[model samples]
Target: MQEYPNYQDIVLVGGGHTHAIVLQMWAMNPLPGARLTLVSPQVQTAYSGMLPGLVAGHYRLDETHIDLVRLCRAAGARFVQACAHHIDPLKRRVSLLGRPDLEYDILSLDVGATPARDLPGSELAIPIKPIGHFHRYWLQLQKRVQKTRAPMKLGVVGGGAGGCELAMAMAHALEEQVYSGRVQIHLIHAGDKVPEGYPLLARRLVARELEKLGVSLHRHWPVAAITEQGVRSASGATLALDQVLLCTNACAPPWLAAAGLALDTQGFVLVDEQLRAQGCDNVFAAGDVASFAAHPLPKAGVYAVRQGPVLFHNLRAALTGSAPKSFRPQKHFLSLLSCGDKRAVAVRNGVAAVGGALWRWKNHIDRGFMRRFSELPIAMDETPAKRPREIVAARGGVSLSAMRCNGCGAKVGAEVLHRALEKLPAQQSAYLLRGAGDDAAVMELPQGKLLVQSSDQLRAPVGDPWLFGRLAALHALSDLFAMHARPVTAQALVTLPLATAEITQRDLQQLLAGAVYELNRHQCALSGGHTAEGAEMQLGLTVNGLADPDQLLEKSGARAGDCLILSKPLGIGTILAAEGMGEAQGRWLQKAVEAMLQSNAAAADLFAQHGARALTDITGFGLLGHLLEMLDGGEQLGAALIAEQLPLIPGAAQCVERGWLSSLQPQNAAAYAYVDNPQEWQKLPQWELLADPQTCGGLLAAVPAEYAENCLQALRQAGCTQAAIIGVVTGAERPLAPVHLLRKADWRELIAREAETVQS
Candidate 1:
């Protein structure tokens, strides 16, 4: 049976703690007619409650973060990995950084706050509010501290609990390291005491913990300027520090005011007791980014977590024409502050208690909260309700079943496909020979030029039809480029899911518009092919090009000493799989998509100019799979791949470690036996990624060692920044396997020698 289309949309702007809860709730009890969408820049959002624990090394990154990608999948929401650049309340549209505007019948915002950077020299200091950015910086700082022989000074600015907790955790972490004695931490705050706003007893307990940890506290120190040298106080006292971490007052994103919404003086979205935007009936705000005008609350994680159920209920009510429920937050909530050394202080209503038991209790509460999202229930595949007898009869009594197949399973009706093609623009090139309305395209070959043909097909990997079409077209053309061919003509093969004539026609038009856009860019004309009905969407293109017979590149042409070059980064396969399972960040998926859509024509031309001996595009088989194909029958010829030199797509390695991979991964990985050191390579988390399948992937070219650097430089100049000489073809003598995966150190001397020769 055909699934009913979603008629209304509910868009969530950020994957904050509240929205994570909403997604969990929605997954369990979804509103039938509403389609949910989440727009966020990250794949995983850090849980503020676990920040200190993560810093203290009590938990891993994945354990302390919510996998927004996977959560969105479980919630059946369209997860767009992009930042909201602007929101037009009047038009009900939210503009994103690099995608189309999203229209919403109901909208919710839970974008958390960032640390205020108003102080002079704040630019040089790392702000800890945007936890994602801070986490990355913290890792790099940790590595720097561990490697330095000289004494290292770290300063934390802000007397609040967040700042204090971070200082203690950082000190605890450094103290556990091998060179812990050389690292010193200083807590600087404008207030006279640390843990400001907490109960007196809580403050005393925190001060004692700081003293025990050898953390020096600088009170009543109003920082006037920050420089690379250190922090400067208004009283002319300067503290020299190698690194400065800011955990100051919260600041709202400036975009809220620019969206024309009523906002508080501090730039937070103004909301009423019902959590609805002050002036916009269809909009709602929650969490730290929102300021409740009736009863302003501290920007804390507890408040955000409590607002989750209220926001979920109000958003659904606002969409369903029901009265919104008012949210009354408790005046005082229990606060547990960790002391970074397996101890914690609990405070409420001016009373306080401290002990190791309190720390254990805090850990249980935080982990229990994380378990809610981390151990989410697997969402069952929903079956569409059966249509009435009369309705089924009108459609010729077709069988009704909810299960739908993907790939060829989602092709459009042949009749519908034909009608759509009849309306497309007619082909205008002489090489077309025969165009649309034909079973298959037949193009005339240019005089004295060799014919080059390549075909590629794939199930829809993205939700946007138009964008998917462009990517599919670009992917199909990559093979021709690998063979050093110039585009001439192309044929389209499209499959679409069951839908009404109007929708089918519209989707077909949009899909072709994207494909034709890319084809036109390469001076290729679309002749025609076939279309059919299926259970899911799929697109394919059979592209033909012209090339000089003698100049064409082949996969079997590699010589023994040629340097191997990869035109794009590895990990698209793993990233796509992670995204499908909702474990990848939106920014990572966006970057992968952009990389997939990039044309390989320029890289191919550069490789050919530099005399590439052998070339092939890395696709379904992956880098190793395609490389093995190049080595198949060549006697005594093997390749050495520097594991570290391989350019990786950002976030790919993390996804692999989390066990997210393509369905074809097992089959691709079976080829790992061809590597010399299988056991050692397999132990690395990034090893499985080598076998992960790719779509519209990069070109793998083997060029003379002398010209490899020039080819790589030209590729980068043409926009292939990740291109690199990953390895080189080796002589037959060292043949335990067809491939050798070596560490970077093992090949550094060889690479240096090659670099000198290239310069000569």
Candidate 2:
């Protein structure tokens, strides 16, 4: 994925099938000088076609969910994991939850509809509009069935095809998975047929299948109200069921109704043949979120999947002033509804069939469709980007782009810098003599205390400037935390790519807001520092703190019996590297982001309170590099670690095995010189993780043996969930190799190995 000079923006506002396919297509044929972004509440989008199979235990999670993070990376798009709360067509901006509004040149909406909540007590009933939320509830239901240790009654509302399939699948799950309990599943419909729009033959076949599977059919029963016990029909007949799965008619999300777009009676966006929102040329819509006004089609996954290519082409056309293409849905398409047990009922053009063969065919088609996103082809265009299209005009023919001059000429405009400074997150400190806008910050030194200071810098890794700012500040603050100091004041040094005055101000404001948030967490005040235009985004922080001489910690005081504890899990570096290459899954990247944003203050304080012998924060050189530095504090003290005891980030092992690593990994390998039998150890994923570079990594401490367990409990209670005891300090047995890396899963085995090594 190459970055070009961006002039126009194309924003996709969902991870639905249509947008997923569009991303896949864009990867193969992207427009130059256009910026792309995706705003989605989820990292993975469920494939509705195979959702029933997934619920029935025939398909796994990965098979039915598409990784939006990977697709965005492949398409050179910025992935924003946040829900869109409002869209302003007139202003050309979309407001997201807890973030700045995103401006767009062209926007498209494919966010699927939620189940209509028309009647009272609908909130009590479990709506299956969002499949992701429904899946979690399903897992809980399975456990509830087993926990009760008795027969249960489950009901599915809506006699539509989705409801019918889900009812049968629920019955099958009870029979196949849970041995301790049985479930009596019921399907309720107000209509004459289980599937409303299908052929008569197809309806008859589906009814027979439901009967054979022992699903109770409540025909002509429209739900009037829901109660604590169960569902009540319009005729006042109530079914006292344990739970209800609502698969009623689709309705637009509440926010969409106020988006100022033309909508149908159901509140869904109205679109013409080209899928462009009516009266809004810059806006487009597809999938369940859009109601085709010319020819109203049923909300089905097949139509959304088919409409993807046309939508993709038209979006590009809109950007380049080319003629747009129109999408025409077929009058009738084949429908394959999964049965509970490896069988499916197929309907097409007044013909219907039921057999196990249909299920196999459906599975093959669904997998093939998924492979388009899972296995993206390699591209040959690795050329360096030409200067981006100008969003702001250049001054005197001097192009202001990724390439800018060095020295004072590259300084940001005074007006842009002033506006950016005024909007920074609130900061206050009594010791600061001057704040931002000064030549340099003047700060009073901490009186009658040991002054602690540290500095750290890194090239921005994540796409979001705000997030990168937050992570960078926390990374720099960890050094002060590890020393058991109270952070007081800090200065920010930022290097951003050259852009227009307005764009620079916006970027700088977001970045500083995030940085100040982290600084404020430690009661640190933001002073002033340098800002310059550069080829890329980067942040550096210089922090000043005060420490009590008696409580101050260093990496040099560990004894032979001290225990080594890590504040967080390893393997974050690998996941980030894989995401950059478009090979990492969405869930994997989410976990990495969460880990990097965590503050180390809590864990450091806990270690200090528990009488930690030595402490250091791990960073670019990896765990082993920092660990070696910690060892330098003592006299030839050796360390022993259990390989399997080291915690790993999700997907880290798979990524490392596939050769996904940060560019700094090779340089960090210099720490491997301390490992015994380096050639043999290098074969394991753990070996690479030991040398993997982390951005906002965690604190590594050596605590006394008696205090290790209590310290761990305190850390977790304070939200250091991944904190654990990984290794222990020991006598200097091997002068050549002081670190003993053993492949043992148990603590006793590690102790036994140390004993044996000492005796030998």
Question: TM-score winner among the candidates?
Answer: 2
lDDT of 1 by residue, 550-662 (tens): 88998988867788999999899999888776566655876798789889988889999999989999999988889988876556678888878888888888888889889
lDDT of each: 0.81, 0.83
Overlapping backbone residue pairs in candidate 1 total 16
TM-score of 2: 0.92
Residues 1-760, candidate 2: write the lDDT tens digits. 1243345678899989899989999888776556678989989999887888888898898899998888887777778888898999998989888766777779999999987888788888788788877888888888898788566888899888889888878877776432333678888888887777778999888888888788889888888998889998888999998888898887998998789999999999999899999999989999999888879988888899988999999887776667899998998788998987778999988999999999899889889999998888533232334443332231233334445556897788889888888866677897889977777888787667887999999887776777788898999998999899999988889897655565677678778888898898889998887888776788999999888899899988987767889988888889988877778889998988898888998888899999998999888889998888888764878788768778888999999999999888999988777776665456789999999988888899999878988998999989889888898887767756778787765554555565666677
Minimal lDDT window, size 10, model 2 = 389-398
- For all predicted structures, in order, the TM-scores are 0.77, 0.92
Error of 1 at 376 (Å): 1.9
Q: What global local distance difference test value does model 2 have?
A: 0.83
Global Cα lDDT for candidate 1: 0.81
